[model samples]
Target: MLIVGLTGNIGSGKSSVARLLKEMGARVIDTDQVAREVVAPGTPGLQQIIDHFGTGVLNADGALDRPKMAQIVFNDTNALKRLNSIVHPAIRAQLLKAIADYRDNPDAPLMVIEAPLLIETQLFKLVDQVWMVTVDAKTQIQRVIKRDAVTAEQVSSRLAAQMPQEDKLPYAQRVIDNSGTPEATLQQVRQIWSDAIDRSQAQAE
Candidate 1:
């Protein structure tokens, strides 16, 4: 299978692009979802986090309090690094397992792993290509504010915590410019799908 690593800065609509790729007949492993699974109640990942950050990081229902955790990490570089250290290994292991299972299935034609920190975590090395979704910073901030219902300052802080979009651009082999209308973005995705098919055929040859 031709594995594509999909990544983008916060509020860049990477999930929407991932869904479109699914519609084009690619199996997508969303790392965000896997990250949650690795830390669900009773998991070692959760225990490690609690041990490091304390029980205050857990919600009343005993689940990881994402908002509180975000606040803690976004405000402190060391905290963010510590959180990534705790969670990234588990997420990577699970992602590799999923990829192995997909490789074993004959029906799996294409695979994409949607990871926001693909470059930062050095996961792009695992894929055949990296596809990045991008938008203007202004558009990114607006979309984030609307979707997350957080203050502009809060959104800015979250965005600040990640590698800038400009820096990530050079790392991507392909770019999906999502600053335009949905129709325009869809056209770009279709082109990528067609290119991927051609690449797969060439590899078989």
Candidate 2:
């Protein structure tokens, strides 16, 4: 399988690219969704988090209070590291299992693991290639503020917590510019999808 690690900075439209890939028949594994599942109520992942960060991170509905947890860790590097220590291993195991399941599926020529922290968390090591989605900083900030309904300061803080987009560029084998309209972005995705299929078929031969 041609396993691609799909990643981008906040508001760079990584999910949009993943969606387009899914529409084109690639099996896409979204790590963010997997992360939430691992920490859902009654899971060992949730229990580990509660044990470390306390019950304040839980909602009244017994689900994870994600925003609350974000507030607690976003500014604190040690706290963030601690949380990752608890969560990333569980996520990695699940990702490996998903990849294995899809590896033999002839229908899925491409497997995209969509992770915002693909490089930071070293998940890129598991993929055959890295496809990064990028947008200008101004557009990125505007998109994030609008999508998240957060103040500029809050968005800046979240951005600061992540590795800068420039630093990640060197690690990417392909970069998808997402600063244009949805149609433009879709065109880029289609081109990449076509090339990826050719590469996969060549390797199989």
Candidate 3:
């Protein structure tokens, strides 16, 4: 199976694109979703997180308090890295298992791994190709502000903490401009899905 990295700056509709890929019959392993699943209240991953950040990041049900934890990392770089350190390895291991299972089953020719921090975590190196979904800074900040219901400065600060889309573009095998309508974005994804199937078949031969 051919593995591709799908990433984008925050608020770039990267999840939407991933869903489109799923609709195209590509097995997409969303690392963010896996991160949450691996750390459910009683899991070893969740226990490690509580040991690191304390009980403050938990809800009444002992589940993760996303906003509280997000606030902690959004402002502190080292804290963010530490959190990723704890979470990312587990996510990568889980994804590798998923990939192995997919290949063993031979269900599809291609698979996508969706990670918001693909570039930041250096996980891009694991993929056969990278596809970056990007938009200009002005659009990025505005979209994030509107979507997250935060101030421009807050959005800017969060965006600043991540590796910029500009820096990631050169690393991408293809770029998907996400500053358009949902229909338009899906159109691009559909084309890529068909193309990837062909590429995967060639690689298998």
Candidate 4:
């Protein structure tokens, strides 16, 4: 299977692109979802997190208080780094397992690993190609503010934590500009899907 590493900074419309890929029959392994799984209520990952950050990070139901934790890490670079240290390894292991499973499945047309930190974590090395979704800074800021319901400052801090779009662009084998309308974005996705199919067939021949 062709493995496509999908990445972009905060508010870059990566999830939307991933959805389009799913609609086009790609098996997507979302690392952000995997990150949540590693820290579920009964897991050791949760215990370790509680040990480091205290019970304050958990909700009354014993679930991770994601918004509170985001507030904590968004302001503190050290706290964010520490959190990544705890969560990244577990996420990487699970992501690799997922990729392996998809690789073994003959019916999986393509495998797309959706990771926000793909460039920073060097996870792009695992894929056959990298597809980066990008948007203008103004659009990114607006989208983040609307989606996260956070202050512009908070969104800026979060975006600062990731690789800049300009830097990430050079690393991509394909770039999908999603700063326009949804229909336009979907049209780009369709073109990429067609190209991927052509490449797969050529390789088989």
TM-score of each: 0.92, 0.93, 0.90, 0.90
Q: Lowest summed lDDT over 10 consecutive residues: which window, candidate 4?
A: 100-109
- For candidate 3, write residues 1-205 as lDDT tens digits: 7888999989998988888888777888898889898888898888988999999999999999988999899779899888888888888888878877876886766688998988888888778899989877788788888888999988877787788788888889978888988788888887887887888778779
In Å, residue 195's CA in model 2 sits off its true spot by: 0.7
Clashes of 2: 0
- Runs with alpha carbons beyond 4 Å of true place in candidate 2: none
In the order shown, the candidates' Cα RMSDs to the true structure are: 1.7, 1.5, 1.9, 1.9
Question: How many clashes in each candidate?
Answer: 0, 0, 0, 0
Which structure among the candidates has the greatest TM-score?
2
Point out where model 1 deviates above 4 Å: none
Clashing pairs in 4: none
Ten-residue stretch with the least lDDT total in model 1: 101-110
Ranking by TM-score: 2, 1, 4, 3
- lDDT values, one for every candidate: 0.91, 0.93, 0.85, 0.90
lDDT by residue for model 1 (129-174), tens: 9999999988999999999899999998888778999999988989
The lDDT of model 3 is: 0.85
Number of the top lDDT candidate: 2
Which runs in model 4 stand beyond 4 Å of their true positions? 150-154
Error of 1 at 6 (Å): 0.5
What RMSD value applies to candidate 4? Answer: 1.9
